[model samples]
Target: MDMRETPGVTPPHPAPDVFGHVGYQLKRAHAALRAAMDQALRAHGLTVPQYSCLEVLAARPGMSNADLARATFVSRQSMNVVLRGLQDAGLLTRPATVETGRARPATLTGEGRRRLRAAQEAVYAIEARLVRAVHEDRLPALLADLDRMARALSD
Candidate 1:
């Protein structure tokens, strides 16, 4: 089956030579990598977002719900879902937010820290493999380029 020129079923459109198209390809690549990372995290009973929240909380303890949502680039509703799951698992606790009485701060418990450590190790192992697959000389420039692309698209 020729995917690029599929038949009567209506083929997918090819990306034009444009920045948006290029960014889409980059995003697709990142999504694939994230899927692999998620698989790696599964053994620790952590989803990708859960692990991300743990990472963020570990680094910035007592982060407000909104701040965590922004840090993880998710909506507050989504953050609540993930936080709820983690809380149910006895991994984290939500306390009153200092800045906003209406919001709560998310903090990792000892159990969450332990699981996060294991998950972080798992993620690093997979990430190391992925990094090794990249060309050595291109890594720095590629990261810088990705940062620029992300900033441009986000703004």
Candidate 2:
């Protein structure tokens, strides 16, 4: 049987162009958010990756460099540079030598925590601005949908 002949059915619309594509919109949104985050973090002497590493380390201390890279959505090499800068600034610490394997766990120092807290206030304000753009009743649902989308893509 032809599916087009089925009752009470309609065909989906084709994507109009780049402007109409959901992927394009998502990319645009990511770029905008990244820019906002970068600007906000800069005031605290932090880049986005640096802030991300500090944030994650605060939450889950002693994570390996590779794990931090994955959590921050950056290449391992890129994360190494971020880690080096943070380490140089005395914002974070790792063992001088790995005790066992090549993976040296990292942790935020007291200074790192202080900087992360300051950065969080700025970042949260930026996030609040975005949340306020959506209706109050729909905000939770919108956040959930975003989480779902991220999970889907990551998997």
Candidate 3:
């Protein structure tokens, strides 16, 4: 059934206002993506942040906890918690104490890479589903726009 034809159906805001705003829609999309990621990673016994930490560590081994926090866009304290969880799970490892500096460099164990590989399959599938929602020709532009938006907000 068409939403427009339903009785008592109305947008929360006018067409040109909040309901149609880009930032509002983006937030909604982000929420949906986060939920999807959480569900996908759950089967691997990992949270989204844990999966994120694993992914970054896979790409750049020996990253400090602070570096992982920045790459994952979480606070240092939060990253420390994630790291401790991963360590306890035997997925990743860090020194008992910082050898050179205050930062402890983290690296994935063989099990970490194995789990990350499995999780990547599921996460990449979700990403592909989202990409398929848009026109093929617009994918590059859409990605570029997202990058630009992040850069703009960061700056």
Candidate 4:
């Protein structure tokens, strides 16, 4: 006899099919975006994390390593290595010593801004392609929905 057919029994909801699940779709989109970014950034000699760090620092100068790591979605340790590399490349600078706190603020040098500007052209082109894939009228709604979904899960 079917459990649902029994008067005293209750059946649990069936799991969603993986292929049609929202999470699966999101993962596929993310993978495609990552691959595209990787290829585009390669010509500029920048990794996704490195590019992200530069972008964030440009808008908010003097961000500490921890804050930059969080903004770039990388670990603190990984951000340290990235900072060191940028420092060596003359793309950014940090004080030799900190008197008040252990957190060292990072600022992009002139070369860093130039590099970021070049990379931004490639990144923005990719973003434009993505935006074109969606309907013009529905783009705003789609962005809002995506933000809402992220906030729901984060909360």
Candidate 5:
């Protein structure tokens, strides 16, 4: 028998309105953040992905392309292209051949660090604006809630 027709069973509830749904709100915020980052990074001659890659590398140098791709939430193919562009721009370096494995770790050049520092100023300002929208005391709770939501979905 169909579950919906089973005795004592309840029908599924209708989905919430898009404007009222948490997932929808999260997506809207993500879209806005991406747009803001794109505009901010353009002045530094970087794309969102490129800036993400650089930011990751600065924190953890010598990361393989695959590692960087996963860290930046991009595809391996896309990361290869981003790395190549940065290498050509003299912002990063990757050895022509690896001694032990297929993954060639990438590191930022001096110029890359300088560019990242400049871009950080712009990106951090945008984040500051976002944080300022919420009450100071609520910020920690908000971050914790976001983390919990992510963990729940991931499981």
Candidate 6:
């Protein structure tokens, strides 16, 4: 068979939107949503990563930098950058842990909680709007599908 003359093979169709392809669409949508979220977080003086750190620390108040990196899916080096920024902002403090003299555990300052409360509202508002973009009944299925996709991708 000529390389170009396979009978069962079909030529690719033209597409207008980059997102017309499944992978492209998913990537584009992710970029769009993340950009929106980052902008929202900016208004509260937080970056998405910082907000994420705040949330995880809020939930588990004594996570070491390494533990925080694991929970937030970030590199320890990058986590240090964010942790330093938040600490400098007086939003959090990462002191040597009482349990482990070598590791630093993050504790949210009162200011961190205040900022987190506002950021949480904005984050949920973004979710509410994005969720409402789809049909109400489809939202649950969409979430399940997204969760499955994330799990598959992680694995």
After superposition, the stretches of candidate 3 with alpha carbons farther than 4 Å from their true spots are: 1-15
lDDT tens digits, residues 1-155, model 3?
75344477665556655657678999999899999999999999999999999999999999998899999989999999999999999999998997577988999999999999999999999999999999999999999999998999899
Candidate structures ordered by lDDT, highest first: 5, 3, 4, 2, 6, 1
Q: Please give the distance, in angstroms, between residue 18's alpha carbon in candidate 1 and its true position after superposition.
A: 9.6
lDDT of 6 by residue, 14-72 (tens): 55444465568778877887898899998999988899999999999978889999888
Per-model TM-score versus the true fold: 0.80, 0.86, 0.88, 0.87, 0.88, 0.79
Compared with the true structure, all predictions reach lDDT values of 0.84, 0.89, 0.92, 0.91, 0.92, 0.87
Pairs clashing in candidate 1? none
Query: For model 2, how does the per-residue alpha-carbon lDDT over 13-43 read when each residue is reduced to its tens digit?
Result: 4554457666787899889999999998888
* Clash total of candidate 4: 0
- Judged by whole-model lDDT over C-alpha atoms, candidate 2 comes out at 0.89
**Alpha-carbon runs more than 4 Å astray in model 1:** 1-21, 96-100
lDDT of 4 at 4: 31
The candidate 4 region of ten consecutive residues with least summed lDDT is 9-18
Tens-place lDDT per residue, model 4, 99-133, is 99899899999999999999999999999999999
Clashes of each: 0, 0, 0, 0, 0, 0
lDDT of 5 by residue, 60-121 (tens): 99999999999999999999999999999999999999989798989999999999999999
TM-score of 1: 0.80
Q: Between prediction 1 and prediction 6, which has the larger lDDT?
A: 6
